[model samples]
Target: MRKHQSAGSAHGLPFSPPRHSQCGCAPARTERCGGLRRSTEPPPSSRARSLRRPQTVDAPSAPGGGRTGGRLKAVAVALAVLASVLAGPVEGADWQAAVKLNAGFTTMSGITHRGTLGTGERIGIDIDGEIERHRTEDVTAGVGASLGRRFGPWLLEAEYVWRYRTDWDATAPTPTIQAITNVFTNVRTSTLMLNAGRTGPFSARWLWEAGLGAGAVWNRMRSDYIERAVSGVRPERRFKRADTKTSLAWNLFAGISRAVGQRWRLGLRYRYIDLGELRAGPFEARPARLFANQGAHELQLALTLK
Candidate 1:
């Protein structure tokens, strides 16, 4: 028999074929055997191993976290309460209360006298060209308070006011036929009124107001007469008379105001008032009567709270 060439030499291959593992699988194809494939990659370097290790990063802290967050919340709540307290009620509130102080310049239309003076029935007498009159111009001060409700841009209020006393002096001729006589009168007046009004805004910080009022006025008058004998026919006579009267009164007013602060305002107003009639004697039969009608210009400062 011919000598059998070695298998490798017979194939004329450069190298011998590799043998299979005992498991019957080639090393490079071991995954086909049904188990996980072994990695053929080279072992990792030191730096690579460090990068692959599980990382533990620290998280960033919040600006005001933990106890600091609690303190911040408390501070925010305190600021809110302070703002409310300092500002008072907001603009949308419907109810308000106010107080005002006023100074006024008043002009009075002179009194009108009616009914004839009888002989010796003379109440105070005057005989200056058959004309009798009493008039006054004065400066007066007053105070007022009000409660109001708002509807849209309109505000309606009910107010009460007290005006201090005012005084006037007048001179007239007496009607006594026997002697040339002169009468001097002193008058004082005080007033109390209740008013209702509506106020509306005209500009960003300005408002207009109008009102009607009804109330009472008290008037006190004192008269002194001096008589001179004309032709020395009658002895000079001097006499005095005093009277007090309470009368029904009414008024109308209009004003414009500018806000001074959150709760205060400054205003200027004009008013027309009528204080009924004043009688020298009782109502049924009076020797004389005086009509008191007046006009006033006022400066007012007010405070309102809601």
Candidate 2:
């Protein structure tokens, strides 16, 4: 009989093969009666191919993540910038409530008499005096106040001003009437207005402001006359007072303000106003309009509270 040989080696050996079989067993242990080598690996099952297939792994959201995360971050930044723009510059300023007081001098136009008075033939009453012909410009005193709200650089205010009485006296001689004649005229004015203004930065510590206003004016007038005969005649005095009249008026003004403290300011202002035609007396059927085409120049010192 031929010598038994193990399948692990090319040459068949009578004793066990020197090398082990590829299936991890010694050739002598695996050899059958015909000296055939038995495989150490088992036969493949149906699921074997599926187990050796490639596997996929998902990556974390980092540098190379999807564009969805990047888009979300960009939208957040845009919303922040939009919120800042809508807030506006005045949002940080503390100028919600404002009040102002002012004291000033007012110079006004004089009055002229344009009518005649007939007096029953003894002595005709006439307007013949310096008081009726000359301009009554005087340095009249005044006081005023304003209350309002400030909106950014703009202001809307309600204002009131009082002007003290201004008077003029004159004496003249009339032909055919032997008497010393004198005339006295006086007037006072007040105003109520709605004003609008704008404020702007000037220098480091100064702010410039300008405004325009329109409203009604009140004018009150009184007139008195005295007649004394040169030849020991009794002196007769006549006086007349008229009811106050309201007329349309308007003004324009400008000023520069300096900050005094954290919540106060002081300013110097110049103003021009047209106090419309004011008419006053008709004493004993002697009708006369005392004032017409009136105007005033005002210089004021103003204090503002914020």
Candidate 3:
């Protein structure tokens, strides 16, 4: 009966906690329970949560952009300079090629060539050849080869040329012998020269050159002499002269070179030849010593490879 009564205490009733607490949850009851137990867990607080710093964002960057920009700038500058340099020469070469051939009169300031008339007569009259008399009026042709290299505005070149001319004439008579005289003169000259000059962006080319050279000029004169024969018969005598001399001479040339197109070059130049003396050649008898100076004019058309 006692055991039944003890079990019946709060047995039929639901589990209960201290009435002073506001929580509906209750501690387990002991026999004749008189105390309450405290909970170890903590309640939720009302304080606000801390915010995380906003993550820093950066713009998308191109890979290798800086280095590529620098390299591209350098390339552009180099190309611009190259283009400026080549532009003028390509255009100038074309025009230079077409009108390369030129013709103009020349005057030689040399002394007269005095040779015995082959009549054994000492003819001392002035034998000066007129400006219209010598090989000054014939054709002037030259084969030119120029090798050049350039650095900045300065340039250098080596050149070689060959020039030739000949003249044949009958000198009209007025004094000693009143007969038509036949004369032939031949001149052959070769030149080697070094040049220094300047060039710019637009095929503006110029050069100054000087040369030391040697050449030979030959003059041949032929005639027949007449003598009064017995009983009004006129006999003829054969008279001839062949004269040649080797002379050391120098020449000066100045010119402007223009580039018209890719393969052509145009140039205009003036030339001067100094033939020291006309009487420098061999004469059968003691010859007269006379000095002479010769002048020339030249033009050129050149082809370029670049």
Candidates' C-alpha lDDT: 0.58, 0.60, 0.40
TM-score of each: 0.50, 0.58, 0.41
- Candidate 2 structure, TM-score to reference: 0.58
Task: Write one digit per residue (lDDT tens) for candidate 2, span 109-182.
Answer: 45544433222233456433323344545556777887665678886666778887766454554433555555
- The C-alpha stretches of model 3 lying farther than 4 A from their native spots are 1-104, 114-136, 168-180, 201-254, 258-291
Model 1 stretches with alpha carbons more than 4 Å out: 1-110, 118-129, 132-158, 164-170, 175-183, 225-242, 281-306
Instruction: Put down candidate 3 lDDT per residue, 1-306, tens digits, no spaces.
Output: 011223334678643444325544433333332465443323333111112245779964334546645644554464455346434464223111122243323344433444333333434563332222433344556565655545555544445565554332223221243333333344444444444455444434533333332222222222222222233443332233444433333445555556557555555565554432232222233232222444555555555443
Q: Candidate 1, 161: how far from true, in Å?
A: 3.8
**What lDDT tens digits, residue by residue, belong to model 1 across residues 1-306?**
122234787678664434555544323322223575655434457535644667799864323346544544554464455335434664664776778887777766655443333243444543432434456677878787766656555555555566675554333454545555454455555555555577888999998988876665666777655565666567776666777765556778888878877866667667777654443422222233334455566666677775
2 or 3: which has the higher TM-score?
Answer: 2
Model 3, C-alpha of 141: deviation from truth (Å):
1.7
- Checking candidate 1 for backbone clashes, the offending pairs are 125-174, 126-173, 126-174, 126-175, 127-173, 127-174, 128-173
Candidate 2 differs from the real structure by a C-alpha RMSD in angstroms, to one decimal, of 42.4
How many times do residue backbones clash in model 1? 7
Better of 2 and 3 by lDDT: 2
Mark the 10 consecutive residues where model 3 has the least summed lDDT: 91-100
